[model samples]
Target: MSYSIIAAELHKALQDQDTALVETLASELNPADLAQVGHHEPASRMAVLLHCVPLDKRAATLGFLEPQEQLAATAGMPVSELAELVAHMSADERVDYFKQLDRERQQTLLKALPPTVRDDLLKLARHAEGTAGAIMTSAFMAIPAYYSVARAMQTLRLKGADVETIYQVYCIDTSGRFLGTVSLREIILASSENQLAELMTEEVIWVGIDTPQEEVARLIARYDLLALPVLEGERLVGIVTYDDAMDVAEEEATEDMHKGMSIGKIEGGLRSASLLDLYRKRVMWLVLLVFANIFSGAGIAYFEETIEAYIALVFFLPLLVDSGGNAGSQAATLMVRGMATGDVRSRDWARLLGREVFVAAGLGLTMALAVSVVGIFRAGTEIAMVVAMSMVLIVIVGSLIGMILPFILNRLGWDPATASAPLVTSIADASGVLIYFAIATAVLGL
Candidate 1:
């Protein structure tokens, strides 16, 4: 059923205080869908509904909720219940949820947990956010390299259900040092008598604990890996799975998308973002762009006499300026996306500039021809020539500026996406005005 239907059912069940019905309905829904269903219910109802689900499902469903919703849904929940939920969560997710709680509350929750679980969570929490160590899950399958294929299969039968993933099993020495990785397929297909060392892939690809989470995602994508091991020196602490990498990829994409449009980073999805948050994220850029536009006004004022001498020039001003802005915005978007995907780098700027120059020349020539016809019909040959020449120069300059600005930002250790389309367009508008007036003065002898 749709989430709305499920939500309606949940609301009715909660109103009637039908505990068994609520548990059955919540159990029928997947964790992700259940999380969405909770969004439609009252926060108080949602809190009661959470108590109906199994602890493992509750933990998974909680991860799907926004931070605000997580807080609301668990308000007034018992510390013992919260500890049970935390224990069921993956290490990375447990740390994330724990960090959101206040220190005194966190201590209470931690104290309720078994000592070993508390220590493991504390160690995972020490990893800085946005690093491999922070995202990796400690609940990974690891077996000694000396175990035979039959023995490995037996171990998996006993422990696989408790771990997050069992597709890729890690091989560790007795000293707790990571030796390599072995796939389940290899173990199943190998002779039963063969040792894990014989079947395992010894050429392990792993990341240091401090490796950036983005780099980890890139590595997983580049290698088509199901999971990557996380190490502190030679000791394996955890493994970052493909699911976590997908989350990082989506988060990074959203952040960059906001930056590309001149909006600052948003804390959560737009559905959860408040009006005040939307305003706060956008107003700074609007204010800055307004000031950046003063230069365009100044450029127009500087050529007052030329404009009066040829009053027809004012008619095409909007068209010329908007065209330049549009061209620059397109170029800036391409550069930002290229940088984000690692398709283009700082050293490739020269090649990118050359390619943009060729492209701009062709686009400018086509547009100039189209505009020059109107210029000829509206005015005369001198004005037509001036308009055509200005189009070519403005387009080339705008495209070049857009193409170069992102590289400059990247080289200076800034986000290339910060060279946003609006910023590029503003810069282009100011420069286009100057180029237009200068060309008009030269061509028409104003």
Candidate 2:
């Protein structure tokens, strides 16, 4: 359905005080988009979703909701509803929701779950966050190798409703030992009398529960499979589907973007972030950035005598310094993005730095020449050459600094993205100021 149509219908539903109509309208919308709009009208939206979406779809949609929306919307749901939702939820989403609740709230929620569902939740919840164990979904289609194609189909029809993917079925032994995987298509094409053991392929690519999400995504993408099984020691615990892999990729990218801006754990996207919340995340870094600038000013102030003698330096300072900041920002942004996407890594540092340095030199020279010609008109021949060379030197350093900072931070167990944007710009700004004055005093004979 079109967004405008949904919006118009929703407006009428609100006016008529028809909760059922609101819920009906919500059922037609995609969960992600529905969640986006839901964040806009917390109380009303939550009511629509809670009332409109059936248990399974609601559980799936809840996984896509912003963290704040999850909290507020699920607050009033009955224990039965919560338990049913928990049964259908992915492990990562369940972990995030459970962690948000207070101790009392968590216990109450846990107590509400069915015995089997509660057992799976507790098992998943026990795994530490930010690991393969935490991100995997418990729902998967696994059958013993002895089952015939017909039996497998029966089993799938019975349990596939709750699984992440039924298109790819995993074959295991009676011991719950993973044997291999078989596609539903292949199974369907084969004789119904054929044994699953005969249909199953021997090459089963699986991930250990402790494997990182990156490796999991990479494995899924590389093999181009619909899903990969997660094993605990030997037994299959869960599976990570391609859709889940995509989620991990997108999340890693978004997290890197947040790190670039020094955002400290603000969830639910920018819309849910409060004024105080934003201020809290940004203030500490801004203060450190402010202090860093003092040195830049000090570099200029210390050379006040030089500036007084060569008034020409003061005239061109902004141009040269800003060029450095801009150049550094470019190189830093590229390196940070490349690192995040896995296009570049620690092993490529030397090659990347070498390329950036040469590129920086060429760019610096072009900008310096243009500024020098303009400076000659503004400050005469000697001062123009001094200004040009200062810009050239600073820009080359800026490029090198940009390339190195990200690598160094990554080495120190910090996200390379944290070194981008304001952090790199501020560092370049201070470095540029000193380079500008130093060039004037030494070369212009100030």
Candidate 3:
């Protein structure tokens, strides 16, 4: 059934206190779909619905809910039940949920959990947010290098159900230092007499615990890894799975997209964000750009004599300035996307700038040719000459600004995505105004 119809039925079942029907409906949906259904109900109702789900699925369902939604759904539930629910959550997700709790709740939850689970949660939670350690899971399969293929198979049979993934298993030495990795496929195909040390690939690709999550995602994508092992010193700490890296990539992409439009990150995403959240994310950029635009006005005011001498110049102002802004915005978008994907770097700026100059000149000349025809029909030869010259200079200047701003931002230790389209356009508009009038004054002899 469609989630929408299921959601309606679930809501009615919850309203009617039909526990059996709720359980049947909740069971029919997977954890992700069940979370979507929860979105249609109030927090209190969702909490009751969660209790009807099987214990194995309950924690996963809760994990899929937004952090705030999870907290709200669990509010007023008994501490013992909460701990039971938390115990069933994955290691990384447990730490994430634990971090959202207040000190009192955190302490209570920790006290209620098994000592091993509590210690593990605390260890994973201690890593700085936005780092590899924070997102990596301790639930990965790791076996000692001395184990024979037969022994490794026995170990997987005994413990694989508890780990996040059995596809790529890590190998460690006696002292818990990382040795290498052996895939399950290799283990299955090898003779039982062969030791894991022989089967494992010694040349392992890994990251330190403190590595940035963005870098982790990039490495995963670059290498096409299933799971990247994370180390602290020489000891294996955890593994960042492909799924988690995908989440990081999505989040970074969304944040860049928001910054591209000159908007701040909107917490909880757009669907759940309040009107105030939307306003707060967007208002600062709009207000700042308004002030930035004053320079455009000032440039026009400075060219009063030029405009008065040839009133025809006023006709082309919007077209010329807007063309420059559009060109600049296009350049900024390309640079920002290139930097984000690691295809471009700050060191390439000089080479890119040289290429862009040639490219921009070509673009400017072409645009100049197109606009000059309109200029001639509207005014005369002098006006056409002024407009065509302004178009070339303004487009070249605008394109160069767009292409270079991201590199400048990156060199200053800022996110290149912060060199957003709106900001670039504002700067280009102001420069276009100044360049157009200067060319007009020189060409028309105003």
Candidate 4:
């Protein structure tokens, strides 16, 4: 049924304190959709809705919801109850929820959790955010290399239900060094007598615990791995599953998109972010960009005499500057995306610049031609010639500048995405205006 129908029925059942019907309906609904129902409902009501789900499902469903929704649902819930529910959550997710709590609440919850689980939380929390270790789940299947396929299967049967995934079984040596990996298919198809070492792939690919989450995502995507073992030196510590890698990729992509538009990360994302939060995120970039535009203003002032002589120069100004900015933004986007996906690297800066030169030249010529038509119609041959030359020059300069900025930022140990589109566009606009007026003054002798 539709969400509206679900919400209506849920509302009625909640009003009547009809626990049995709520529980029945909750069972039929997917956790994600049920979470959506919680989004529209009041925080008080959201707790009632969460209560309808089975305990194990409740934690999973809560994990599936956004952090804001989770906070709202659990707002006034008892600390002991919250701790118990959080303990049931996946290791990574549990840490995520725990970090969102205040110091006092965190301490209270820490006390409520069993000592073993609290220690696991503390260890995982120590890993720096956006690292493989931080995102990976400690709950993973690692079988001894000496175990026979039959014994391995038995171990997996007993343990698989609790771990993140069982598709890829990690093989560890006696000293707990990571030996290799064996898939469930390998174990199932092989003779029962075959040892895990015989069944496992000897050439295992893995990353160190401190590896960046983005790099982990790239490895998973490149290899099509279900899960990758996270190593602390030679010992297997945890596994970063494909699902977590995908989530990191998506979150990074979203962050990049926001940054590209010159907006910083707004907590709860754009849809749920408060108006004040949205204002803060956008205003910083816009304020900087406004100051950056002063150069354009100065450039115009520098050529005040020329501008007055050919007042028509003012008309095509936006066309000239905007064309360059658009070209620059286009190049920046390609370079940024390539770098983000690991297809491009800092060392490839020269090669990227070489390719971008030819590409920029082609784009510059095409855009120059397109804008020249307007130039010729508006102000005749002299102005048109100036506009065309400026277009070609500015577009080439803008695109090259845009393409190289990311590489420069990356080389300086900064996020390449910080060379954002608006930043490129603003810089391009200022330079393009200078080129346009300078060329006009030279070509027309104005």
Highest lDDT: which candidate?
A: 3
Q: Against the hidden reference, what TM-scores do the models get?
A: 0.95, 0.92, 0.95, 0.94
Clash count, candidate 1: 0
- For residues 231-261, what per-residue lDDT tens digits would candidate 2 score against the true structure? 9988998888888789887887788777777
lDDT of each residue in 34-60, candidate 1, tens digit only: 888877677788787788998889889
Candidates' RMSD to native: 1.9, 2.4, 1.8, 2.1
Candidate 4's TM-score reads 0.94
Task: Give candidate 1's error at residue 30 in angstroms.
Answer: 0.6
Clashes of each: 0, 0, 0, 0
- Each prediction's whole-model lDDT (CA): 0.89, 0.82, 0.92, 0.88
| Models ranked on TM-score | 3, 1, 4, 2
Off by over 4 Å in 2: 84-92
Candidate 2, residue 221: Cα displacement in angstroms equals: 3.6
Lowest lDDT sum, 10 consecutive residues, model 4, at 263-272
Model 3 Cα displacement at 323 (Å)? 1.5
